[model samples]
Target chain A: METTTLIPTGPPATRPRRSPARLVRAAAWIALAVLLAALPLYIDTAWLKAGQYMMIGAVGAIGLTLLTGQAGQLSLAHAFFLLVGATAYTVLAGPTDEERVIGLGLDPGLALMGAVLISALVGLAFAPVAGRLRGIYLGVASLSLVFLGLYFGQSLDSLTGGTSTGRTPATFELFGFPFSNGGPEIEVLGVPIRQAERIWYLFLVLTAIAFVLARGAVRGRVGRSWRAVRDNEAAATAMGVGVARAKAGAFAVSSAFAGLAGVMTVLWFDILKPDESEYGTYGINVSIAFLAMVIIGGLGSVPGAVVGALIVNGLPQALTLFSGDLGWFGETGGGGLTPILVSSFIYGAAIVVVVLFEPGGLAAIGRRLTGLFRARPREITREETS
Target chain B: MSAPTLREDLVELQVDSVTLAFGGLRALDDVSFTVEPGTVHALIGPNGAGKSSCFNVISGVYRATSGRVRFGDTELTGQRPHRLAKLGIGRAFQNTALSPHSTVLDNVMLGRHALTTGGFLSCGLRLPWTVRQERRHTERAVEICEFLGLGKVLHAPVAALSYGAAKRTDVARALAIEPTLLLLDEPAAGMNAVETAEMAATIRDLRDALGISILLVEHDMNLVMGIADRVTVLDFGKRIADGTPSEVQADPEVVKAYLGSGSEDA
Candidate 1:
């Protein structure tokens, strides 16, 4: 039954050909990275702090995008995982001699990792429920974890340090090099690299790592399985992708990312204060903010997520920075538009405009722009070669 | 379990008096068929004749109420739907269930899921072995796409493909599994005449080249009669006739099933 006639006349091998457009894109990315790396040297401490805050949002948004966007699992439990990471890191690295609180006195670097692992474990614990549900139902169910986290944060006084007085997290360090001010007296471009500058560099490195890892995952096997499960469960199963396992893995990985973001959050604020109300830090608001990042970024696109984070998280920080100079949102406390309120209105409107005009977010626009340039010449050449 | 290795083994598929009931509705009742090694076996019937149900039962989507399905030595009934791919059972859906936004190559590479190893960590890290495995599988997937005339559109999104091309992409995906038993549900359902003829030739080529048994569910009589080595006719969840294509065409019950009971004497 051997047929010798048919041969596949495919268009070249599967190895990625470096076309002009690809080379330009790669060069653009490197340029952006270099520009970002140089920002700490030029920008003042306050601006650097604002940038660090954006990096935290970037890290968290990347995690949320992977779960909600890529894996097609809606989750409001991100804030809860963030709390887990924050508390785990604090308790693990806190002074062992503190009489009122629990401490493992582990090294700060190890504690950071421990916190991520713990958060992932907590996420896996919720997987059975996550696997059985879908879409908005899963979103609502995961929201319950936020309330659980709030309750735990208040009652677990030894770990969380209670809502009345939040515990101070240990300063993060990598070996002998502290991310804080005390480790070494250093200067970059004759500017003293103090707390704000040091933290900026730390957050930048974390964000970079998170971004690269996410891009890799999104391009590889894990991503294919996620998309398969997202598109059609029956078809995914037929293709031998374990539906439950993929869902679980997505949740766990997303939680780990969220957990790292949580550690960053504590570092940013210099405290692990559980929210007093449902609207506080580690509350439903933060969860929705992250979802906004993923949605506004363009669901399932890795680079899209970073842009989403910038818009969603950067808006408020940018508004606050501008408020100091431009006298916008001049009144605070009561009956006036604060920077937070103004930024909220702006991003909320941004989300509406994005949904109505560009559902694929800024990323799809970028792709179309590139596609427009690459379509005619490249496709024709490839077809002719074939 | 050691990384789900696959080999194309030519073995008989036995559906021993399988009965599938959904509450009061009997989707499949006492249906039995054997697909011998390396042959094209077609199951054909009119609408509402349980053709899809029978496909579901074989693919482990629905468990039989009674009886068994054996692929070689393995009991296929009650097996987890995902595990069937590891046993060399590849299925292409009738409506072309694929990730629309993903590239054709990505969708086809999904069929290699069972054969590959690694999860979030290894893949995310782009580990040395995982990268190698991905490159190798991608080459194989590209070849399968080219074999099905999808070579030029490998990077095109599945949503952007034509209806016939999308249908071929579905088949290309199934072929990526290197399956010993390939299940094609209505492969030529929505194709034009030329596309249907091309699909028929592709199917014949697949059976001849790969030496694998193909169990097909189709309504296209011309295509079925033209290519199928064995034909089974089903009516109201019951097997009406099973024989060579011409023999089944001559059977009165088979004719009655296709053209309503009023035209039985036609």
Candidate 2:
């Protein structure tokens, strides 16, 4: 036997190098944040309301980014999770009505927790099958959940208030202030902001938290493991990464966020009904809309998700206003072609464009724009110095 | 020659009466070999001689149809590759299986995953202790890269590396696991003479510095005869000769397999 000991020749230590382009991008984000913080004072009420919806959608989109982008899993059941949360909140927190037969007598906060927990549990149950199935199979499996949710909502009439819509009680109170009752008015720079402003602020806070958490998740070991598994499952497994566990974890996290969005939606609307035909609740349309947000944004990029939601959500509202004013289709229809159809068409177009031209989505576009701007400054400085 | 100093208390890997059948065809047939620890053991054979299959069996990539594979006290016969790696056995594939999209450092860090603690949450939060662990592992990975003269490309994507460099990166990745038994499956497969010489030096240096046992599978007899302490020659999924490199080289059966019949007596 020959005894040999291999001593690795370690690399020389060096200082961490910072790219100037990154510093410039950081500065731009700071500027954008400051500008957004000041927008309530100048932006009109309609735009502000749209902004609120955008922020809410951003939370759900971030979760979708993690599921599709990071873990290489596709989910079309996001809105179903939202439906669960909203319905859970309505049934649990609403006042008891013997005739209605749909009240759980749970506190609002507790109901919110229950909603999230229920969604997570549902995710956990489906993860084994969902995680094992990849590509088109996973997509089909998740799409089935949408139908299952719709069935559950319709079949359980007494629990879901049936086809006839019912009022949700104004019982949710925080710190002696009744949130459901529309407590206090908000103002910015002498401008009296409506209830929408209050909702906007809440959405903003949630969106910010979601963004930070998503960013943290993407930059860490978990993110690395996810990418490894996504890029090559065999390599990841050989490195001791638990592929199934990571996939399941992504599903649970995504479901939890979707649930949170559902609760937020209920807070905005102040009611939940199984029949969306009347009140817009039990349907496949919302599920499609949310998928549009994820696909339009960029699958894995956090910032891309936010931008995608804004474009997908904001576009239809703008188109609705434009069509009504222009009388493009007909004069009799004031609401214009249904918001769902318009949004869906544009979203479908966006998905195609992104897949063909820029697969990285809006995030890649943002990076290229920032890079171009940064390079210009450097070129100008060099010319002046020379 | 006197028995090597490191021979005492040696734990030899034993593959006994192993057979592997895929569908109707038999890939391996009753293969048996004993590889002594602390020695450079070489497995050489012609194309389709089931050399790769035996490597796969020992590294837990394939379960044998019959017989057992023992790496020291552990029965690695049916264990998964990752589980086998944790038991102090590491493998480098013949063709580089490195992550092309990841940086060299990140690729190496994948190997150190089994040693690291702190789950997803801690890593995401950048906890103080996990940060410390990450930095330490990164330093170790850098060291391995430098040892293989890959320091200059540590931050570069593995896709950007030369064929030989990429292969070395794979070897570095295996070394990052800190295994007792390292398996290099055709490490010199596509290397030129200069790269092959460097690889041989690195292999020798690996043994000298780490004291980790290595089993090299190769087709190049000159490279094998140069560094291998003991060479085992296989032909048609059966062991033909096993002894010192010179002894195996001089064996009539081994020479006949390499050269055509009757030329071996030359």
Best by lDDT: 1
The candidate that achieves the highest TM-score relative to the unseen native structure: 1
Query: Which stretch of 10 consecutive residues in model 1 chain A shows the poorest summed lDDT?
Result: A1-10
Which parts of model 1 have CA positions greater than 4 angstroms off? A1-12, A375-381, B1-8, B262-266
Indicate the DockQ of the complex predicted as candidate 2.
0.33
Off by over 4 Å in 2: A1-27, A89-107, A166-181, A184-188, A191-194, A275-292, A321-343, A371-386, B1-12, B190-198, B256-266
With candidate 1 superimposed using the best TM-score fit, by how many Å does residue B62's alpha carbon deviate from the native? 0.5
> What is the lDDT, from 0 to 100, of the residue A68 in candidate 2?
84
TM-score of chain A of each: 0.95, 0.84
Candidate 1 lDDT at B52 equals 94
Candidate 1: docking tier:
medium
lDDT for each residue of candidate 2 in A1-386, tens digit (9 for 90 to 100): 11122444333443343667668768987998787777877877677777877776888888888888888888888878887777777777766755765787777777777877787778778898887899878878888887777777777767666656645634555454554326676556897665555566667777877787778777666777777678777666666667787788888878877877887877766666665441254355666666677777777888888988888877766666667566655433566566656666878899999889988788888867765766444322322332
* TM-score of each model, paired residue for residue: 0.95, 0.84
Q: How accurate locally is residue A64 in candidate 2, as Cα lDDT from 0 to 100? A: 80
